[model samples]
Structures are given as structure tokens and as C-alpha cells.
Target: MSMYCNQCEQTAKGIACTTHGVCGKDPEVSALQDLLVHAVMGLSLYAVEGRKKGITDPEVDRFTVKAIFTTLTNVDFDPARFQNYINEAVAMRDKLKERVGVSFDHNSANFQPASDVAGLTEQGKQVSLDSDKETDADIQSMQQILLYGVKGVAAYADHAAILNQTDEKVYAFIQEAMAALTRNDLEANDWLGLILKCGEMNFRAMELLDAGNTGTYGHPTPTAVPLGHKKGKAIVVSGHDLKDLEELLKQTEGKGIYVYTHGEMLPTHGYPELKKYSHFYGHYGTAWQNQQKEFANFPGAILMTTNCIQKPQESYADNIFTTGLVGWPGVHHVDGHDYGPVIEKALAMPGFPSDEDNGTVNVGFARNAVIGVAPKVIEAVKGGAIKHFFLVGGCDGAKPGRNYYADLVEQAPKDTVILTLACGKFRFFDKDLGDIGGIPRLLDVGQCNDAYSAIQIALALANAFDCDVNELPLTLILSWYEQKAVAILLTLLHLGIKNIFIGPSLPAFITPNVLNVLVENYNLRPISTPEKDLEMILG
Candidate 1:
């Protein structure tokens, strides 16, 4: 196989993408990502030892997580960027090795990456996924599960750190997990335990991220976000970073430019700090999967703050820019938060010629908002006004069967409340699900990273009703596309929540044996049609 990646739901033919990634990642870029991951694995070796000696480097910790996040699906497709990360990883690894005064005969610990991208690609082919065929398939699956879960945790940890909220435990677990991937002694059961531990670490990382976002911007209040555009020069900020959006908003204030959110940034409008900007106007487009078409029609500049960026079309190639860990070849990369170039681009372009009132969608029903009205919610449930609650949200994708989410949401009984999050809500966000007892039937719980909020809301309800979360009349019908969703699933399993129905397709990395383990242990099932699944769930 020239390249092997099955980290997402839309892998080629529902199996491994053996040639090129379906996410527009070429073979060379894929190879470089593989090598970068191996290099990080090497750095993690020394990092684990350095911690044992009570010596830690903040640069190493930060770089380790950021580098892993760079390799996540749809984050960076630039081979040169991956090459730089690989070089930096090796340099930090050797620097730590010198400080610890330690040496090892293991190939991973002593490996050296080539100076050139061509040579590094060769090195990558050697250390690619499943390089060690001697390992059991189930064990390999568990190891990959742990690795991807760590990637999700790294993404959250990086976001949290950006907001000046961080915990060393998250970094330590990332390094330990990467270093553990080099070991040959762990059994399948042992790997399973580590996977659960990864889940626990993910929970902490997400908690830190929750605190960072809410603390930095204040808890999101119920806000109405416009779906239409206003007349002015405009910039649409995509991805999941609120700080980036805040910085752009600050720079563009009084510049006669209107800032609109796209994709996951839609939730940022609910933040008090970000929404305080008068020029922060409305939301444009749907999820990342539809960006190419939606962006082509947009008349202003585009700033991608994080992942979920696609190959830009020729029509708007000059209008799109990427920042942070998100990168595309030949696309202008903005460093830090200096958005001067973006502002200039937006001003240079012709924004909407006339205003369009496309109505609005309500966001900001996070844990705080939901729990703020716990009495009302609990009373509604007790009074038999609200029936079962369905938590139906996750990463949206371009693959078939994703329409199942919109179908499920539409067909959901009026008495049932749907608590949604992530970009997947775009399928039915505009639907007037109506309210019960002054409570909106649909509650947006924020981004995929905000799963902690959903968990807290569930726990609060469970506490109010005096029952386990699973015992409550709530069901999780989730759709996943990437590692973040994988991490959230692991967190749910770690919390001992049962009967999670995930679709449209399961992870390709999971072996049948490992799948059986999750199914048996957690009662996890692949989602059937919306009709069948809803019947089974609501019955």
C-alpha cells in the first residue's frame, strides 16, 4: 500500500485508503504525516523519561500535542509543514535525550530522520501504520484507538492552552501514550485498559477546554444568529477557534467590515466576549463538507481558523486563508492572530450588494444555560410534557447516509427534545421544532469539543431524577467523521454510558474482534435507518 489511512468514516470503499486519502491528502503528504507521527513517537520516548527525572520542557509538551493535532484528518495537507514538524520533533527528542543523559538501543528512540522531504518520505514508508505485522490485529486496533484518542485530546489541550487554560496531566498522558505505542509487551486486555485511560485523559482535556472557552468569553447565553448577510465588506471565519475569531473581530472593528461565522465557528456568536463586537454579523453556509460550494458563492474573504478546510476552488482560491494548525498548499498562512492581511482582503472584495433576511437560529444552550433552567426542564419531564431526549449531533461529512441525522431530527416526536451540537446540527438547525412549556424543543449544546457540557447537563438531569444517565429517557444517536468524535465516544464509554448508536459507518481502524469488545461491554451499536433506529429507541 502506498498510503494507509482509515481514521474517518469516509475512507475509500469503507475500508483503508491504501493509495490516497479521500480528504484530498496526497500520497507524499500522507507519507510525511506518517513520518511526523513516528518522529513525535520518538520525542515522546525522551519526554516520558524526562518527566520521570522530574524535568519537563513546556516547549516539548506544547509541540508534542500541536504536532499530533497537525496530523489529524483535514488539518494539514502540506507535506512541507509535516517535514518541518518532523525535524522539530527529532530536534526536541534529541535535546531531551541529552538532558536526561540516557540512550536506548530501540529503533524508535534512536531513529534519525532525513534532512530532506524526499528522504523523510522514504523513512515514513518504513514506519507507516502496521509496520509491525507480528502484532495481533485486535491489539493493533486498540493501539490505534489509543493513538487517535490522544490526537483528539491534543486538539482540545491545544485549544485550551491557547486560552491560557492548561493542565500538565494532558501533556503527560499524550507523551506516555505515544511512548507506549513503541512497546511490544502489552496484551489486548492491557491495551484496552490503556484505551480507557486515554478516554479518562480526554475527559480532563475537554474539561480544561470547556473552562478555557467559558472562562475566556463567559458562558454562552441564548443568542439569535442570523443566517443571512448584511450589506458591507465581509469575512467569514470558519473552524472552531474562538480566540482567532475574537482577534479578527477586534482588528476589524470600525473598519466597515462585517464578520460572519461559518462551520463550527457558528457557536462563537453565543459567546459574550465575541458577540459584543457590533461588526460580528451573521453565519454563512453550513458545515465544512459544503464549504467548496458555499464559499464559491460568498463574495468576501475567508479565514479558516482550524481544521475542516478543503481544497479551495479556483474561483475563490485567493479569497481563502488558513491560520493556526490548519494549512493548505499554496494557501496564505496567517501567523499568530495578526489578521491585517485578512482585513485588507475583505475590504478589497465586494461583499453582499444587498441585505437578505434569512431569519435566525438560536444557540448557547450549554450546560450552564440548560442547568439554569433545570427546574423547568425537570418539571416538564415530570409533568409528561417532554418525552425522551435524543442527543443527535456529531461531525458532519460529505458521505452518503449523513442525511439520516436530518431525517431523525425531523421525524422526532414533538414531545421529545433534541439536544444537538457540532456542525451536524446544520442539517435541521433552521427547522422550527417548536417549544414545550417555553422550552425550545431543540437545544444546541455547542461544538463537538463542548461534549463536556452535554455530559454535565446529563449528569445534572440524572441527579435531579435520581437515576443513572443511561436509566434516564435519553438516547445518543451520533454521527462521527474524525478523531474528535472518536475521543468523545471513548469518554462516553469511560463514563460507563451505554447504548450509544453511532453511524453512518464505524471506524475502519477497528477490527471485528475489538468491535465485539465494545459492543459487548458498552452495548454500542451501529445505527440503522432513522426510522428503524428511532423506533427501537423510542419504543
Candidate 2:
């Protein structure tokens, strides 16, 4: 009765998170998130109406992206924050109505939520993924997919917004689609079409972020990042935010501290502007899911810039920090992009006393990097030196089923090239897949949002080959865990690429009937053994 959440791939027991979220979200926090989503959907009803009157507010658009983003798993877990967001969402909705100078009797426009915990829970009880009492199970499944996909869009767009990239169309799509969720008229086919359209919007969202990141820090370059630490005071930064990491590195300059990238932040070092920092030592650990143990054993402070932050262990909880939209109940949150608190914590903590040769992993094969060598890659493909390209990327998790990604890379044919993005590449990124004519068989295409890079690379290759991207020798085995991954998957579908094999499993929200539509139309397959899926893909 406390909560009901299953928005992420690694939901508790592969179903709903009732009592506590697997991502460390408490029941009250989860309930608040539910209430907040309910409130936002109501706001979207009016926002959609006001937009038709040509009354649009960028702040409401920006807030829409952020408020839903905060509810995503591992992103935020503060009930108070959700309450404030809910109140603001309503205020913005009502204000937009007044701005348009129109009045309607829709219950959603007049919706009001209780300010207290008990009242919020009661309000949330009236909301569900499929509000239509008569929706078909299959149609409802597509509805969930669409809803989750929008949440995914919000997560990425939120990051892009922080970097000062916001699109009015993306905002309009978010509000329009969230309001669509409350509708009772859409059938199975209608919902499926909405899914594809959402994918198209997500593609634009990803492109905006790609531009945001590259514009802010320059396009990522291929660079070798040291996996070991330097002997000095250090601050380890995780998550996918480059702006925060750059700020921390800027503040820590000449302060006798080394800034080590962790999790998805590892790719930040490949940016020309960021890599130029002398005190930017190297990477600190593997993926986000391993942070608990890796962080516990680390010698310095840790700053989590985004999601996948677990409950900090008491051993190093005092040194753990959060920034941007990420939150933990008691952890210090960096305000105004100031990293002084984190720097002081790093200064007080004992960092690595001696450097170790922990090897290195290469990254930053983004679009500019990959396309820069297009002629070389194209010649290699034409000369038959490279027969296949596999894009295996997405969020990494603690699930035992996630081993398939590592296994697929190991089992890939020697004549093939593996192009990966996101935290999932940590599985076999350092395995030394060697080279095919000076081109490393394994190419790291930046972070999860940078899947935009992979998509661009695919399109360029397809253009060179004079064929559709799917007509080229390419297969995408996406390993999804959270909403960002959902957004990316939808982007791929939107591009009309088919025959994607996703695993460790499909989203629990996909009902059997809805899954059938995906299988029949898109040939989406649940990943089996790597041996089997690879054989199917390669042969």
C-alpha cells in the first residue's frame, strides 16, 4: 500500500516496487513521485490548451522537463522536493490558463492536490498508468511504453536544458503526450503510432543534447583515460553531467586535488576543453552500479552528479555529495554549481598515496570523431576488412542477467567492429579487442545520451554504402535499465531501423499483446544467449 513503481528495468522482483524502490527510493518518496506525476499530467492538460492559444511559457516548459525527470528512478528521493514541484506545476498550469484568457470546465484544469502527506497519498491513489477503466490490456501496455518513453525524454532533455538547450517542440510533445495518457479514446493502433512519434521527438531531444554537450565542451575526441588514481587529494565525480564535472575540475585547479571521473563521467575526459585540465587525473571506477563497493574502498570524496546513486554507506557517507537534479535525503547538494564544499571534503580526505598501473580504457568516439575518419572506415568496409558493425550500448545495472552484453562482445566475430556508448560499455571496454587496420575493433561512442553519435555514425555509413541503415551490416543489442535507455530505444525505432535484439529482458510494462505488435512489426526480440543472438544477427 505504500507505493507502486516499476518504471525502471531493474524493478524489485522484476515487478513493482511496493514498500521500497530498488534504487533506494523510500515509500514516501515513491508515493510523492506518483502524486507529482499525477499533478503534472493535470498541468499538461492546461499547458496543451494554452499552447493552442499561442500562450507558452519557457519556464513551464523547462519545469515540465525537470519535474518529471526528478521522479525517475535513482534520480531523486525527497518527498519535500516533490511537494514543492507539484505545487509549482499546478501554479504554472493555472497561470498559463490565465495567460491565454480562456476558461473551461475540465476537471484537470481545476485539479488541486492536498499539501500534506496523507492528502497527497489519497490524491495519488486516484492515478494509475492507464486511467481508462475500459482500456484493453494491449492498448494499456502501449500507453505505459509511451508514458515511460516520455519520462525518458524528460531525463535527457533536462540534462540538455541544464546546458542551456531547450526545445519548445520537445516541451509541447511532453505535455501533449502526458495529457494523452489520461485520454480514454486511443486504441491499440493509435497508441502504437504515438510511440513512434514519441521516438521522433526523442531523436530531436537527443540531438539537442548532443549539440549542447559538444557546443559546451567541444566534440569529444578519442583519448585514453587512465583507470588508476594519482597520489594526492582526489574527488571522484560520477553520473552523466559534464558541466558539473568541468566546474568541479575548474574549482579544484591548483588546490592540490586530483579530479577523477567515475561512471558515465569517464567520457568527459575525452572532451578537448575538459581534457586540457592538468589536475584532471583519470577515471576512478567501473560503472554506476558498482559504486557502493568501489566508493567504499576509495580514499577520497565522491560527488554524484545524477542518477543511479544508492544509499551511501556510513563508511563514506560523510564524503558523498549530489548535484543538479540528483538527490539523497541527507547528502550535501552542490548549489549554484559551486563545488567548494566537495573540494574541501576532498582536501580533508586521504587520497591515493601511490599510483598504480591499473591500465586504461579509451573513449570519445562520438560522431565528430567517428565521421572524421569516415573515409578510412568506408574504405575498410568496401575492402571487406570490416563485415559487420554492432552497436551494444545502454545503462548498466546490478542484474545477473546483464552479463549478456559482456558475453556478446567477447563472442563477436573478429571481422566485426563493436561500437558502444553509455555506462554499459564498462562490461568489456578494456578487453583490448585490438585493431582492424589501425581502427580499434571496439569504439566507445561517448555516454548514453551520446547514442546520438552512434545514430549519426550509422546514418553516415549507410549513406556511404548507398543503402538504408538497416540494409548495412549493423545490429543493435540495446541493454536498457532506465528511462534514458527507453528514450534511446524509441529513437532507434523512430529511425525505422529494425531487427533490434534487446535484453536482459523487455520492459515489464509491455503486455504480451503489445509485445507481439513490436515483434511482428519491428522484429524486436528478447535477448537469449549471446551465442544464439549473435548467430542470428551475424549469419
Q: Which candidate is the best by lDDT?
A: 1
Q: Where does model 1 exceed 4 Å of error?
A: none
Report the number of the highest-TM-score candidate.
1
lDDT of 1 by residue, 1-539 (tens): 38888888899999888888889888788888888888888889899999899999999999998999998899999888888898889889899999998986666677888878889888888886567788888888999899888889889999999988889988998999998888889888788888998889889999999999999899999999999999989999999998899889899999999999999988888889889999998999999999999999999999998789999999999999999999999999999888999889999999999999999999999999999999999999999999899999999999999899999999999999999999999899889999999999999999998999999999999999999999999999999999999999999999999999999999989999999999999999998888998889888
RMSD of each: 0.9, 1.5
Error of 2 at 115 (Å): 2.6
Worst 10 residues of 1 by lDDT: 103-112
In the range 96-214, model 2's lDDT, one tens digit per residue, is: 77777765454556778796876776676566663446777787778878888998899889889888888888999999998887677777778878898889999989888988899
lDDT of 2 at 266: 81
Give per-residue lDDT, candidate 1, residue 377.
Answer: 92
Q: Global lDDT of each model?
A: 0.91, 0.85
